[model samples]
Target: MSIQKEDIDHLLNLDKIKADEKNAHIVIDPDQCAACQAKPCLIVCPALLYTLDETGALNFDYAGCLECGTCRTICPHLKKWEYPRHTFGIYYRQG
Candidate 1:
């Protein structure tokens, strides 16, 4: 099924979403990741925070991140991708 804003809200509604808006916590080096042909992180992220821009460049939005660390493990470009520090990222109670 296609995910809509309401669907996302419904899913996270029951769970507590503690956002650390002060910091992005997760950072991506598009220059380095650009070399990666197979971007599994784009699909592995449950929150679907990773997306492609109109120019086909990698785009990432951490606003609705679940901080599941899926991107960290799936991405081959380890030189840039990383999870937030302790208690510095989005926390989903059960989302």
Candidate 2:
């Protein structure tokens, strides 16, 4: 279940995002979220996109999210957040 170069390459190919590329289209809303007390997003996020700050506030690392939708589904509150840019977020392979 570890990541590899091909996974990264595949995502880049699909999203057309080159290495060291900038995905300005990627965005996340910390304030919009209710910051689920359980914070299941942290556990379910395969890419560890959801994390907490020193102050315990939600810190969203969009780049690491696999766009798995686990967070969206697990959240009792759907903040109606948008998906990562077409070529943005984490990429993966079966191997």
Q: Best-fitting candidate, measured by TM-score? A: 1
Candidate 2: stretches off by over 4 Å: 1-35, 81-95
**Per-residue accuracy of model 1 over 1-95 as CA lDDT, tens digit each:** 77865676778776655556766767788887687788887778787778888977888877677867788887756554456656665555753
Clashes of each: 0, 1
Model 1 Cα shift for residue 71 (angstroms): 0.7
| Ten contiguous residues minimizing lDDT sum, candidate 2 | 16-25
lDDT of each: 0.71, 0.56
For 1-92, candidate 2 gives per-residue lDDT tens digits of: 97654675555454432221454223445654544567787677655656678988877655544556777777755545456555454454
Whole-model lDDT, model 2: 0.56
Q: What is the TM-score (0 to 1) of candidate 1? A: 0.70
Clashing pairs in 1: none
